[model samples]
Target: MPAMRFFVFALSLAVTSPLLAEEAKPGSPPPERIVEQKIPPLTPPDHELDLLFAQLKKERNPQAARLIADRITSSLFYSGSATVDMLMGNARKATEEKRFGAALDFLDQITLLAPGYAEGWNARASLHYQMGNFPKAMADTAHVLKLEPRHLGALSGLAAVLSQSGRDQQALAALEAYLDRYPADRDAQKRAIDLMIKLDGQRT
Candidate 1:
């Protein structure tokens, strides 16, 4: 499969500030440690899945929603561009509903259907990271880097996953690589700096 590129450049990390590297204040525990959590895949494509998509699009009528989404998917599957977008849309809807497992499944489908689409892999990586599956997330990010060497999103994702996984040095390196390519990425740069300090303090 082709490398998956990240959408880091398109993401707004400012929405959530990065945690600094300082020691936790007195009486406070360190940041919560995240571990990989295995999630079972949802049932294969069905009328209910189509209805869910339609409901997400503001369609109130269940019957109509299922019909429309099914029709769209039928035509979308054969076209790479459309298929990617369709799958992405479904993933987004699943995420909005806090259905992380389903979102991952949708992303998985995207990768299977359109392995060459950098965006598909990137999206999958994001979902995996959100689920605390750092190893899987990192692997997907690497795939993105292979497809687009300068993908800021993948670089940032790699950095985040590495930091969380206790591979701070590697994370710092990935972040530095991203900053070198995007000098104006103040948010990402700040995150990298904060994570570096945090990791360094751990060593000291």
Candidate 2:
């Protein structure tokens, strides 16, 4: 009877010990393994500009394209800094009042404060152009283009600068680039055609 009891106890130990050991084992998987789920990365908020640019490229209607261009311009004007925006406003007022030196000072401060802001360079480029500083205007336009390659204003300004410098072929090429991005601009199309005609006449 003792032997029978011993045998029964051994059988119960053999059956239950492994499960108990496994549960206490270090780094052992639980009875139900939990899989860790991976999270997707968040998209950037600036994708709005990408969507707007895509819409601008696809829209064939001139009036609709103009409206889209206006929106893009408005978006570009926002320097993301209240101080810079205020300086820009002051620069505009100075320009309006023909206070060229004060306007330039404001623009200079804006560029220094926000070197990454393409709008500051663009505004400075326009001011330089108005002041007959073509070289400075051209340099500022180059900075604007580097910061925002798809900037319609910068592309147009680049073309204008090239044309004024008497580089007609280069001017036409720049205009062609502008038209490629925003083909619905009637004025740009006319200007491109005019440049082509002018180039053809010059060749003769």
Candidate 3:
């Protein structure tokens, strides 16, 4: 009986020995230690921007989308050239989502970070138009034109916002200016013709 009991005890030790060895091994790190070693830090225009962009893509709510876009744009500004496309993409996404506030914030960062970027001011102006801030939109558009005289989008955006705000005469002038620069732009030509008719009707 004692021999049998001793045999049983030895069998139990043999069965548990591997687990004990695993627990006692100095070369093997603990689970928590392993996790800490593998974890990475959050950096600008990469991890943080990636997360924000994912949220923007998934969230249908404009406010939530705007918040994430703002965060991404702000964070990405520090990454230099790597961030230019990312910032522009985020701004465009925000605009498409109709999150004007977020788009404006992103554009603001662009102007501060890359002041010479014509698209930045143009995009901000477009955002202002979407937000119904006509005066501010016109101002921004004007700046874009000054920086890049042949910027079709800025001219068209100015015309659109002017027409929306009952400044048909100015809108017509802006459209003409755009047509002068982009004579081959069939869309701009068509828009100019439409604006001229509208202005004539308003005058009559």
Candidate 4:
């Protein structure tokens, strides 16, 4: 099998451990620790998303496309409720602190409080992915897509889940769809190409 590149949300950190790094033993080297942190993106005005999406579709410049995609992502985080936003912030902080359970709790409240908010589902999906709960991550991703079919993060996430499950064909299709919406995503484009080659080789 070809090496697969996993995708995570730009706004999220990829946490590999739920515990803090242990102190180095006497005369031993310190353990290397990887910590992932998430920076909450600003929520752009609702009226600007349409224009931003349009620009994203037509943007060929990598830098410009990234800017447009960031703007679109920002809008996705808008829940229109202060309470939900606060809960989401707490979830982010919890995740950063490696308090996965507490993060999940905050995420659960956010999802329940704003079931219509796609970001709530998206956030939970990211946490699940980080926790190696692919099934739950995929389920939350499905909810995100149902709420917002054009969600770039959800599309990429679905591809990641499918790829992890050994469903390369489905992953390729999902990634292609993501590229169709955001062509300037170089990483997704590369993954899509890799999948195409792998599948084509299987046909021979």
RMSD of each: 23.5, 25.7, 26.4, 17.5
lDDT of each: 0.64, 0.78, 0.63, 0.80
Q: What's the CA error at residue 140 for candidate 2, in Å?
A: 0.5
Considering lDDT, where higher is better, how would the candidates rank from best to worst? 4, 2, 1, 3
Give the TM-scores of the predictions, in the order they appear.
0.58, 0.77, 0.56, 0.76
Per-residue alpha-carbon lDDT of candidate 4 for residues 47-124, written as tens digits (9 for 90 to 100): 687688788989999998998898788888876667888999999999999999999999998878667788999999
**Which of the predicted structures, 2 or 3, would earn the higher TM-score when compared with the native?**
2
Model 1 worst lDDT window (10 residues):
1-10
Q: Report model 1's TM-score to 2 decimal places.
A: 0.58
Better of 2 and 4 by lDDT: 4
**Residue 9's C-alpha lDDT in candidate 4?**
36
Cα error, residue 67 of model 2, in Å, equals: 0.7
Best by TM-score: 2
Ranking by TM-score: 2, 4, 1, 3
lDDT of 2 by residue, 1-204 (tens): 132332232123210122222444677665664344432211113577788888988999999999998988888887656788799999999999999999999999988977878889999999998898888887888787767767788779878977898987767767776777788999999998999999889889
Of candidates 4 and 3, the better by lDDT? 4
Off by over 4 Å in 4: 1-47
Which candidate, 1 or 3, would have the higher lDDT against the true structure?
1
